[model samples]
Target: MTDTSDQLPVPQRIPSGIAGLDRILHGGFLKGGSYLIMGPPGAGKTILGNQLCFNNVAAGGRAIYLTLLAETNSRMLANIQNFSYFTLTPIADTLSYLSGYSVLEQEGLEGLTALLRSEVRSHRATLLVIDGIVTAEQAAPTVQEWKKFLYDLNVAAEILGCATFLLMQFEEGPASQPEQTMADGLIELKVRSVNMRSIRELQVRKFRGSAFLEGGHNFAITQEGIVVHPRAEAVLAVSPAELPKPLATTEQPMRMGVGITHLDEMLRGGLPSSSTTLLLGASGTGKTLLGCHFLTQGIMQGQKALYFGFNETPAQLMRKMTRFNLDASRFVAAGQLELLWQPPVQDLLDVLAERLLNAIQRLRVKCLFIDGIGGFQRTMASTERLDLFLTALFTALRTLDITTVCSVELPDLFSPTVTLPQTISGTTAMVENILLLRYVELHSQLYRLISIMKMRESGYDPAIREFRITDHGIEVASTFASAEAILTGIARFSTVTPGVPPAFETSARPLQEQQS
Candidate 1:
């Protein structure tokens, strides 16, 4: 037999234990490499170092943390006390922290390099973190000497199969540093203020052995250390699973009801299943009510459902359901239905998407109702990411076969300018269906009109209908074809009667009698 013992084992990764961060790092830091973490003061560098040490120990690996700057040990440990990863451990066997300022003072850079090598080998450490690396740079006699010290430390680390991090303080400024090119990976953290709101972001400039997400991802230093939220477009660039196959019929796929009897007929059966639908309307146009009906109908049909809203709390929503005789609290309590309500406040876009997707999977949901998608736009720090964000979000929804309905509030109650609303224009092309609800002026009175604007693939009735929200939920009446320019929300009829209703408004008017 041939000798087969010469093969080397493949290197593994060291997880940071920060939620949603490993994905951005492309499965965390690769073992046997050195990384540089640069940021200003109070940017969570110390928190990250301790968090990584505890994570490595929890994974059955040893770690050594060396600090060169001046700080009391109690104050450093105080910041990491709240997180679960900061549990006390046997210092000799697991995680060990020691001050290296004396070694660097007495013997200089060469002595520090030897000290790091000695400590790592003695502890059998798989992970190492050198906090306050800038002190070493300032102590070096020359820039070339600093670079040499880094090269020696990195080589020793790789040979010993240990992943290393050098934490350095840096003010927000330009990049062109000498040490940046020498490290195997470089990560930068920043806190920027936009419109009086602070946004914390992380960016990975370079990685040697892995391909990482390239963008400024949002991060927060909560009680659980540092939690990063990767950009949605980058993380979900491709759908997690394949989308459902199309139906055999020509342009006709599966259809699900919109909860109203006559509206389903107007929809030529119902909205397309596993499709994204947008409800375009202004405030008080029954958008939330219509979404409630959609979720109620799905729950009644024994399909799991989710209602994610920013404006309404669970108590408020349950009260509205009671008004329509649709009691959903029972299903909600049974875990068949879930209500995910985030208050209208500043939030990370990718964080919301993470919660949305996780809830869908938790409930095995089939129908989804987003009460006000424009709420997300209002809370976002960057407006340019709207198009790509929604496209990726809806693509992931389709991959899970979720029939989604989103309510978008138009700026005006009635207008004829033919302009897309700034909040929703980026999402029009991403959805499969569009339904319009607007107030049309007729006979000195405002009447609401509902119409199907577009059905991308399915065939449907294009007639404009008058819809009413009564004590019995949404009721769709006959088509309002007697007036021209009804779509403009300023209807014009040939009849001159001011008080009397038009003939088309009469309930006795036959559906066949209306304009085809």
Candidate 2:
């Protein structure tokens, strides 16, 4: 016989016609093979199938689109032309569409098979598409009929040696039929919600005889068709390069002055640059005012700073700061300070990351302040809310070599038996410094007490200091000594016995004699 092996036609590789998608597929679908596309309703199943048919014809291979639910060829063409791809006249002319079977009628599957066979032979078709097999299933009178029709159709397409694509609508639960088992390849489209926003994902569930990407990737549909953004984990196999060496001057630790001279002295100069500082206090305890002082001082030192306000608008914030004698309008007008007032309502991680990146680029900021962390609690899951947000925020701020200050409202300031939730208090230990602000009773009057609870990599004064908000901003008053419970937000004094000597003399005497 003539050399039969040499007579076999070479297989063709048809392009998916989607620029980004084609890159992921390593070219496109293979000729003389079958594939299945599974997704829920409104997942753009029909549109993707139509693009495949049109693209094949444009590349010099004939295509036949067999639709069970869609309308006639003219209607399909008119609808798809709205997309820019209508200019491909060659594909438009060579493409053939067939759809007239009623799924409700028992003749739907039979009619499709007859039409498919005829079109395959007449056009010598290299590619075939079944717009939807689910439509046929819905039309069948009984489950038995549906199973038979699906099995027969699968065999017919395989025997014809035409590269076929079957579009199926998947239900919410598991796949009931063996359709997925029979197909050579299966692509699944899924939708998921992140922070109340829907995200589209595509996963290659199965692809026989080919090394395919296994995980899901993000994608979007636009007027030009479907576009897929490959997951970072999929393409970036090598680790990133180590960070660049810091400038000679930056290698020496810098001080982030606390905006007030007395506070800086209490902190032993100031907070370290590139460090995270936690300011803990109750509501209306001047936490925001302290943060504003930090930002204003940073701007004055020629370093750009950012202030994120969760509770006030930019205009309102500026007006409020003016009352504290810190004019913020000058720094804003000078492009040295940026005020981001809105609390992110979307994926807090994504929104915060994006905004921080933008601020670093636009303002060249060196310091950042989050007015309060409570606003972000609702945006993330409870278990990971605190740690995840803190880690991400810390990492981003560190990348810019920026000092970050975060203020948090404490539930209880002095209850010895009360313990804060792990999510709320755990992040405090992660910072380089912790500043505690409390309302203390001194001389039978309530005064603000400021103390440095923790200071890493530096020494700080641990004694509580009295402070007040004055016309010139926050000013520290002289410290006082008392033998009463004054730091617990209340002041009470006990009467000294007549026989009790001075505190110094009582220590020198015996315990029995002092008690007597």
Estimate the lDDT of model 2.
0.69
Residue-level lDDT tens digits of model 1 in 1-516 = 756787666658888777577988878898989999988888888988888898888888999989998985667777678886778764656888888899999999999999999999999999999999999999999989998999998999999989999999865565656678889999988888999988999999898988889988999988778889998889778743466666776556778788888788888878888999999888888898899888878887778999999998989988888887677788788887788898877788888888888888888999999988877787689877877888888888888788999998888877854356675677898899999988665445566678888898787888878765656677676555532344443544333244332344433222222221
- Candidate 1 similarity to native, TM-score: 0.90
- Per residue, candidate 2 scores C-alpha lDDT tens digits across 288-330 of 8889999988887789999976787889889867877788888
| Worst 10 contiguous positions by lDDT, candidate 1 | 507-516
287: Cα error in model 1, Å: 0.5
The global C-alpha lDDT for each of the candidates, from Candidate 1 onward, is 0.81, 0.69
Measure candidate 1: CA RMSD: 5.0
lDDT at position 510, candidate 2: 18
lDDT, residue 193, candidate 2: 75
